[model samples]
Target: MKILIAIGSKDFSKPTLKLGMKVAQAFNAKTTIIDVGEKISEFSSQLVELAQDQLESWDFDAPGVDVLEWAFNYLSQNKLIDTKQTETGFPKNRLIDDGEGRKMVYLSGTACEDVNLILRNGDIIAELREEVQFGEYDVTILGKSRKRNMSHDLLQYINSSLLIVNDYEDQKFDKILLPLDYKDGMLKVAKYAIRVALALNVGIDIFTVFDKDKSQKKGSNYFSKIIKFIRRSGVQYSHEEKQGEIVEQIIKKADKNKIIVMKASDMSPIKRFLKGSIPLSVMNECDVPILIVK
Candidate 1:
């Protein structure tokens, strides 16, 4: 598995680092930590004076390779190169300069064999748009402060699964709230939930708000498939059917502390839920990290 951890220094969260590592270690997946440095809108007086004849300007990267190297070394020296899984790999490290007056630092490929790093300049969203889809990243984990979450074009438009890290605690993903509608993507969404559940050593509660008569049979088949998947995953889990309003039941059943996983596709239920509500109220109001699968 490949995991991307993005750090916007202004809203950087230490929990993001911890959660990234925990997930990586749990799945024995490679993790890339991205440090999106500050942007320079204008050239500095010293730089301008030094290169008076120069018309072109480029992004400046600070502590790019050196900083990431130090961090990777720290993790290795501390024997952090370990996970519970038998397989382990770290992606390769890369430093990139977009030459648009923005810098980045990438960390990866320490103990993980498949891990890779990437550094980009200019806007974070622009870089993501160029790389995330093209690279086929399985999951992207990002740190969002209380003041900010997934409100940008990059996050909103990405096709891969996204794990927004926020309002987190030290090991509190006791149960994952999976809101399903017995659709084709349910299994795909469950795949991600399995990864998270294993990573956190938590139980999976497969749930769906049904329309009673219309969904009972389909819901049964859905639960049967989900049960088979989770059993194969060798993780503790349970499936239940509820009759009520979908979003309301989901919100009421899921507290702020539980991890909620959902797919990003334009499913009918999800579309109805979002259009009936604000832009991302189900995500924003929950006050918890949401895993939106592709």
Candidate 2:
């Protein structure tokens, strides 16, 4: 498998690269380091020179030479190279395009580029997954913003075939959570959950949560469907049924390094607010990373 590290304008991307390398080593995958940025500036000659030295030291051949030339050209154009200052469009377009069929995109900022998106670093750490995109790879690892209290600067690492880390160590996920709602969409989500279960040598605890007395019969049917999903994944797992709030129950089961895989559902405004946004809720309360697959 090939993992691409979106080594863009974020300087903190080094940690992500380290983590990604670790993941590649574990999954026996290849790492493709990529970067997209505006031209470098003449005023930052020292920085540019430093980068040139790096390229030379690595003896980075043809493709690397082309990349450095592009950086120099961007600097000549007097354009900003940072992802944060851009107002043109999604700063992640390049990254996301590279992410096609990729495990996950390691986003650096708390909230994504668009929307009122905000993420707690701890929550993001908890939600990391090593499998995504129909069991193709693990989750994408991103760094946090260097802003305000946003700079947690914790040496946390999320595991994937494309692992990114700050130091040398094996951080494997040992437990996983699979929450299914039996929606047709969930079928794909189940495959991702099962893939991680097997890859990390982790035990998967699958659960279904629903409104109390709302659909006991339907819930049973859903549980059966999820079982089939797990069986198809060819992994050993435990199954359970819970009657309670969906987010709360899922959060209760998550731990650091525990990946929770769930289908992305369209939610109403009130529901989003009440649940406090499923992704946000889990990110905030779960103390683990929650992987939401669409």
Candidate 3:
């Protein structure tokens, strides 16, 4: 699986980097680390203040002390990026494969353009989104909080199998909650969840929410394949049926230590927003990190 990781404000918070690295190693996946650089304007020559990221507190002074410079230094300090990559000067717009075929890729794009110039000169958000799409990343890891509307749009667009790394103390998770509604392609979701569950060495709870009036036979028939798949994988799991709003049910049942894995709807963006589908609802309402498989 190819994974994309976004650094907050183009800076490497050690915790964030460690968390992303752990996740990449867990999946044994190739990872792309991206940072959007805010440009230095003539008016703000002393420092660059990006209103886009609401980074007023940060002083982006020139000559070795900006976030971009900071990123390279951090990588070098942590031995994430080679000293060669840091020599001379780091490029403003760079796409490096790193050649090592290691777990992480180093990427940075200019986030200097304003909204008025976005059409002619693409902005940072657009550039970041484009890179992720170009890489066809299977999963993207980002901070729990995203400030800008454009950042949110990027998230929604690239919502395919997202793992929002919220307060990740460790890679450890108590259990994984798989919310199955018996939809098509659910077996794939189940298998994916099972793989993760196996990796985490945690039991999987294959659950569904439905009214009592509905026939148990239908739920049993629908989940039979998925159950068989999980059983074959030898993943310890329990199946449960609850009755309530899907989002509410999952949130209440999912403990703080549990990671929730659910299948996301691939409906059109506008349509999905209007509908506020169960997955979206869970994403907004639940405090737990969600692994949405599309």
- RMSD of candidates 1 onward, in order: 6.3, 13.9, 8.5
The prediction achieving the highest lDDT against the true structure is 1
* Candidate 3 vs. true structure, TM-score: 0.68
Residue-wise C-alpha lDDT for candidate 3, range 52-108, written one tens digit per residue: 224423533322224445555555565554456556554433423343221222433
Give the per-residue lDDT digits (tens) of candidate 1, residues 57-91. 34332433444444444455545643321133222
Which residue pairs show backbone clashes in model 1? 89-112, 89-113, 90-112, 90-113, 90-115, 91-114, 91-115, 91-116, 92-115, 92-116
Candidate 3, 84: how far from true, in Å?
12
Instruction: Answer with 1 or 2, whichever has the higher lDDT.
Output: 1
Local accuracy by lDDT, each model: 0.61, 0.46, 0.60
C-alpha lDDT (0 to 100) for residue 105 of candidate 2: 24
lDDT of 2 by residue, 28-83 (tens): 44334444334345688568657855875776532223432332233223332234
Off by over 4 Å in 2: 1-31, 34-139, 143-172, 212-217, 220-223, 267-276
State the lDDT at 137 in candidate 2.
Answer: 37
What's the distance in Å from true for residue 147, model 2? 7.7
Q: After superposition, how far is residue 269 of candidate 2 from its true place, in Å?
A: 11
